[model samples]
Target: MNRISLPALFITLVLTALMSATSVLSQDSPSRVLRAGAYAADITPTTFPVESSGSMTRRTADKAHDPLHARCLVIDNGETQIAIVTCDSCMIPREIYDAAKEAASRITGIPTQHILCSATHTHTAASATPTFQSPAAENYVGFLTEQITQSIVRAHSQLEPARIGWAIGNNPRQVFNRRWFLRPGVSINDPFDRGSDRVRMNPPANSRDLLQPAGPVDPEVPVLAVQAIDGRPIAVWANYSLHYVGGVPADSLSADYFGQFARQIADLIDAGETEPPFVAAMTNGTSGDINNINFFEGGGHQQPFEQIRIVAGDVAASAQSAYQRVRFETWVPIKMRETEIELGVRRPDKDEIARAQKLIEDAAPGPWSDRRLIYANETLDLAKYPAAVKVKLQAIRIGDLGIVSSPCETFVETGLAIKQLSPLKPTFTIELANGYNGYLPTPGQHALGGYETWRCKSSYLSVDAEPKLRQTLLALLGEVAR
Candidate 1:
């Protein structure tokens, strides 16, 4: 190198600066935690309401609106910059998820790994999962995706430091086991036994049963509330094992019982007695075997639509009870962990496949539902293995409070597992938080064959996903804490 004149020296300095600028432009900056806020958009589903339940119209009505729900949560927990959007829909194809993540990244500098988008698994809402390939909902999905991304961006702009709290309350009575195992040649539903309606129910299948009695029950209603320092409710999320969707027959889009309860939380909090700008984001937990108003059990509550309000009241009461009795704290590290774990999907025996073909050929009835029959027929050609299974389990530690996400419809056993092993003084599990992959049964429950135990064709993972998932979640908790 040679000494340069003053003019040459200045030119060289400018060139060096330009080179450095080019290098910086070529790569993304080292990621860092950022501010957070949330925004929600309403895209409620609609259809002509038919009098399936308690409606003034014994005939029908036109275009009854069903409420769909969605929310975006921005978390700057000091570890990862995360943007989570929870939608009350069927499923959002992996593409929508990726696009949403990309949008969040572009708008807020959050990486896809840091962005978590999930479905609430409401049948009443528009289908996000292209898995079923609905030509009708395609436009709705696109519309919803944009809305969600915008919500994330808006929330990011409104980011502020917030304190979070966790509380546990028992609405244990509301959720119950829906699965009943038949003994070797037992009734699926006992007609002799007095039904909830006094009218007996015919057994679904009364022959060649192996087991007896009702199946498992998960009674965990995990409540996690987040509030700003100013005492404004940022969001209230809940997980309870109650399968109470009412499974609407028509097109009317509604968030079902879950949305009703969520609104109840908002109502309770927004009464000016507590705080303003509070949002309630409720999730479903291990409700694979749980239901609130059973068809054969309680004569369907005699009230259908009101069931939403009824459970909403229950959740509101429980949440208020928890709020009144619980303590609050902040400044805890929130760590979210998700893993792709392979589960053992069902593969019927070769003989059974052959037998099924023969039965179909003979025009004889099969032992499975139309869906199940289809699954069985296609199981052989099933290219899916390792299931690309993704379980999003998260632990948010706020001072002494802890909140964890059980991605599956975790069985009540799964919640107990978290509570038993969690290092946090108190931990709550929020269901349907991350995504919906159907039921997650305990090891033994898998032995009892039913809808809950029926292996999904997509995940093709283990029926015994609960225990292993619980252990893996605990390990993630350790990593985040450490």
Candidate 2:
């Protein structure tokens, strides 16, 4: 037996006791848990003969083929809480969105900044902007606010210990770049201008007739899966870039493929009455110049409701793959930050404004020659009001996933750039969030000249607005990540 010095023995005993105490403390402490809940509210118009927004032509829908909803998902990581609400509407105007968010914040105790609201951009949905002062449009705004607020509150009340997983899956076959580059001398003059555009929207589907696509398509379908602590799924939120998949009959209000896709996903996951109320949502992605029409194959010939089913099935499969790939985390950091900026509207020059006024004044009030001219008149009307518009940008960091949202119809390239520059590993962009300010095309695309770049109420932002919005969103992402 070796003899040990008294001081050495004492030191060794102290160290052992400290290690034992540390182990006991670590074992005694409770593990932090992630909590999540989902709720959806029916926001379909109650009154009949409602004007559904989309084209320059006014369309009234007395019936709804499918139910429209305001879906919400609430996530909490012990320290921070985030509420993501998506509405099936053409556009949620800033005023209405602000009111709804404020009410939700008060009811749920989540900060107004923490609530990120977005629109699914379904053209068949009721108009929420109230730009035309139509009775149905104006009344629907109040109804929409109440439904969304109730959704957030209900989600908050249902929060339970849960695990979250995020993944990105590719579905490149569905979405296509809508803007096309026509062959030389194939440019046609739009009603807004006598000048012909080198690049135009929805060119002939035949490849031999067109040069190529003017832009790129973002085929990424990002999914966030929420599951109970016992491994039961609660909800699946997926984002895609294709614009509305229109297959509805005339004068019919619907959520289009978004509502269909959610139902399909829920069924695929087997979320039924036996299990917890499982909610699924498909949020609109950066698709300012993207849509479901595969011009390369053919245009205007797609079978009506069949295409929606096909697209929904494909997206559901992609969601399943993504869910399988991600590793669910029970505890993770969650943070949310928002920023608001005012950007000047791109007003028409005096000459163009005068011409538009003259055209509207000279024509009879019955009907205009072309529908595009009506949009031109709307531009002049808007010019008489505000010179600038406020844009809301938000960023949320959940573990390794980063989500950035913009109120404008963002372009695919902008979304890609944000994802690439994000500090978080997997980033996704949500467009038409909080409010809708029209298409946000890059300056380079603006130079190419297309329907998206045309200066009208539909897309009224200044030329530099895209860059400004991009930089602001990036900065917000960095802040939240830190």
Best-performing candidate as measured by TM-score:
2
Q: After superposing candidate 1, which stretches have Cα over 4 Å from the reference? A: 1-36, 45-64, 77-80, 93-95, 130-136, 182-185, 188-216, 247-249, 271-277, 294-301, 348-395, 433-436, 456-459
Relative to the unseen true structure, what is the C-alpha lDDT of residue 326 in candidate 1, on a scale of 0 to 100?
51
TM-score of each: 0.73, 0.92
State the lDDT of candidate 1 residue by residue for 122-235, as single tens digits: 555555542221223544557776777776787677777776666776776566555655444343321112122211112333324323335555555556666676767777
Give the local distance difference test score of model 1: 0.58
- lDDT tens digits, residue span 1-482, model 2: 99999999999999999999989977886447789999988999999888788766667799998899999999988788899998888788878888988998988899999998899988888888643322238767789999999889998999999999899999998899988887776646676766756788887676776888988999999999999988888888899998888887768888888998989887777776535588889999999999988788785556656778888899888888888897899899888999889888887778878878887777778345474567567668667757788888999999989999999888898998998999987899999998879899999998888888777656889889999999999999999889
Q: What TM-score quantifies how close candidate 2 is to the native fold?
A: 0.92
Evaluate residue 193 in candidate 2 and report its C-alpha lDDT on the 0 to 100 scale: 68
Give, for candidate 2, the lowest lDDT window spanning 10 residues.
129-138
- Model 2 residue runs over 4 Å out of place are 1-31, 130-136, 299-303, 366-369
